[model samples]
Target: MVTKKLYYQDQYIRNFTARLQKSGRDEQDRFYLVLDETAFYPTGGGQPHDTGTLNGMKVHDVEEIEGEIRHYIDVPAEVHKEYTGELDWDRRFDHMQQHMGQHILSAAFEEEYGYRTVSFHLGTETCSIDLEIEYLSDEEMSLVEKTANKVVMENRPVETRWVSEEELSNFPLRKEVSVSTDIRLVNIADFDYNGCGGTHPDSTGQVSSIKMLHWEKQKKKKIRVYFVCGIRVQKQLQKKHKVIQDLTDTLSAPQEELNETATRVLLLNKELEKKNNDLKMELIEYEADSYIEKANVQADRKIVREIFTNRPMPELQQLAKRITAKTDRILVLLINEKDDKLQLVCSRSEDAEINMNDLVNHVLPVINGKGGGNNSIAQGGGERTISAEQLMDELVDHVKKISGT
Candidate 1:
């Protein structure tokens, strides 16, 4: 048996009496109760389903399957001869306001700039419509918002009428209808006429207000215009005002000086960062000089092996480069055991005969790591199973074998 949809007759019907038809379980083991007539709207047309109570059971979801409107409850309900369904009016009215506002805003865009609405979405906090146009300038957006607000202020009646497919030509429709049979067209006076199944307010003024927040290019020639209506516009304004006030207080400046104060603060931060980096580089250079003095001299070739605690990887590279630059007879091997992980860096002078890449390749597997580099320099990191001192000793042994020492 097909469930009669009562919402089409009255969108403001908060309570309805219906007859219980059947109760059953689906393949997913979910219980559902069917009614002979229902005012709860099922999920369709970019709008969500109505959530309320049915026969004292919490109705989490309402769906129309095949020909029956199933009220999926949180728990199994006993079959009753008569059932009472209550609608969540706040949710229902909010949807009506946003949905009706969408029709007006979309119509305003079309009337002002010939932009066609291709799709729409009623989100939790906002609503958006996709337009066929590639871009919408700020001025064009302002004009459309102004036009929509003017319609809302005029308090025009919103009428719904059932018409046949042949009768559709009698009205100026903004878009084509999807269903031929049971065609319900929502008309906004002479402004907009389109086939829609969603619920809406009785008048344009009930939408309260419509505010276009912003717009962005979605894909190829489509632009998504984000907006809010009714109570949401006031919410957005309150949030923005609080943010501005906080910024004014924190910066010790008035609202008018916020832009200039922010720019000056950012510029000063950049300068401080540059000076800090210069000082760090000078410190690393001096540390490199001390490392060269503490090297182990072998066969007239200087070898520098050191372990650091929580030193940055870049500083290790810079120290290696500085040491190698000072002398062509030196090989630098550096490791940092910071953060309970092992990291290695190997560098050699330009005239050094040893291939640092080959040395790194041999040491990496011992700690389950991977790395590769040119003949003069290489870097790698791995697990901390072995101490940094152990890796350094292994690297020295490899160098000795290469030098036949």
Candidate 2:
């Protein structure tokens, strides 16, 4: 026989007595108990299953499969035929508040705007509803939130009843019922009527309050609204307040002045960064000039070969550019040790006879790194199998041979 779902009869039923009609273990060796009647709400309709105790044994999960409701438990139930089930009221009531809140909020969207809810998910900490629309403006969201809270304030009775398919047309439903038989309708007084099997509170006010956290466009045309309700609203407020207080202390400004202070700080940081970059460039130019003056003259060609320990690649490039710009007669071959690897930068003055690409290509395999560039400049990095000095020596020796120096 199909197990009776007591939750549909009374959503507030926390404790109930039922006769243990069946007991067995699943493939995973998880013990399961089947009761003739139960208050446990199985996982369905986007709402998670109820978790509690059945005959002093922990009911970890409740699921309905093939018309049979199974209460998966931590251990085997008592050998007795009768069992007492106690629901975790906090989790159940929270879910009820969130589920009912969704109904009210969704109905408000439909009544005010033409937005239709395409999907709903009741997550662990928050819930979301995907609407069949591309976007929801801030003003439109505020209107829906206001309307939903108004319904909660009105404390309208939330009514649930099972009706046959023929009786469906009697009430205005938000959407058509999915089931032909045992059609359960959750009606919000004179506001909303829809087919649903999820548990809900008796009145909209019991939802406490609903808040729209945010919304984003999904799948190009749909809008997903993230929200929280009941106790979660207070929890969100507390978290935001804590963040505000921390920012106030960090910025040394009051909450009201936070926006202005943050903007000012960002602008100041940008200015400081620009100034620091200018100073770094000046130092790089000075260092590059020093290297150019120390270049070795071989066969009437100036070659500046240098090795830096643990230097960044960008700095090497910048130094090479500065050295070439200052003197067109100097060939630059630079190497640096960075991140446990060897990096090389080769550049030629416009008058130099060296081919940077050929030099880089010839040395890359020596250190197991790959790189490509034009004739004037080339760069690459590879494993630290060879020291920075070795890579620099290889490039210099190649340049010397090519220049016949």
Candidate 3:
């Protein structure tokens, strides 16, 4: 059985009475009803479906299946009876504005620069159209936007009518229709004429305004243009204004100077960071010199072992490197305790006999640690089941055993 599409008869039909002819569960186990007639718009042609209430039951999804529009609902309604259907007018009008705005915007590009829109999508927050060209400059997009808004402001009458295949040749259509028999055309005064099966406003002015948000390159030779229309444009502006106001309060700068002040502050931070790092390096060097003066002599090399509190592994490695670099035959072992974790760094001079990697490998297992390096340097960390001083005692004993002193 065929269901009469009430929307095509009158897009403004918000409330209607339709009797259900079929009702069943779909493959998804979703309960649905197929009415003898419906005003609900199904999901198709880049436009989403309409949602409302059927018999006061929330109709969450409306879809066309096998030439029938199914109104999917949360609860099943009485079958074979006339039920009141209410369309969410707010949502329906939003789609109408976006759909109409898209036609105008797409025509603007084709008219000005001969770029055809390859595809279109109507999203909840914004809509997009894919252009056939590989790139579109911001300046070009702005010009197209200006042209589209001009048409909108003109408030040109948008005409829609059914036409036969042979009759289609009579008008200057932007593109050919997909279906031949039940073909419909949407014409914007003298601007554009295209085949479409979506609901649209009677006048271009109802679109309110069209604003191009941004564009990015799609696949090989296509670019996707993102834009918003009507109330969406205002919502985008309000959100951005809130962010700017918060930033102005935090940075103590006017909106006009936010960018300049932010850039200057970032540069200042970088300079200060470099200065602090240089001071840290100088302090590490002084600590290294002090360790060298207190080192103990073993067989033929000096042993410098120290435990630190809340020190970083990088600084520990730098301190060990400085100590070994200043003397020819010295072994440097450093460990740092921060909270409950320990970090170890061991290194040796070019002539030192002990293999630092082997030494670290041998003792780190005691604290369930893990790390490895070359024969000269090694570092790793594990839990602090043992104190830093106890780990130091273990390292010194192993060094004596390795050196046979």
Which candidate number would show the highest TM-score if scored against the true structure?
Answer: 1
RMSD of 2: 3.5
lDDT per residue (tens digit) for residues 44-159 in model 1: 88788898998788888888898789999867767777889999888888889989999999999999999999998998899999999887899999999999999999999999
Local accuracy of candidate 3 as per-residue lDDT tens digits, 1-405: 778899898898999998988999999999999999999999999999999998899999999987889999987768668989999998999999999999999999999999999899999999999999998998999999999999999999999999999998888888778896889899999999999989999999999999999999898799999999888889989998999999999899999999999999999999999999999989988988999999988778888988889987888888988888888899998899988888899999989977888999998888899999988889988889899999989899999887788
Q: What pairs collide in candidate 1?
A: none
* Alpha carbon lDDT at 146, candidate 3: 100
lDDT winner, 2 or 3 = 3
TM-score for each of the candidates:
0.88, 0.84, 0.78
TM value for model 2: 0.84
* Residue 136 error, candidate 3, Å: 2.4
* Tens digits of lDDT, candidate 2, 27-129: 8899998899999999988789899887678888998987789999877765558898999999999999999999999999999997999889999988999
How many residue pairs clash in model 2? Answer: 0
Q: Rank the models by lDDT, top first.
A: 3, 1, 2
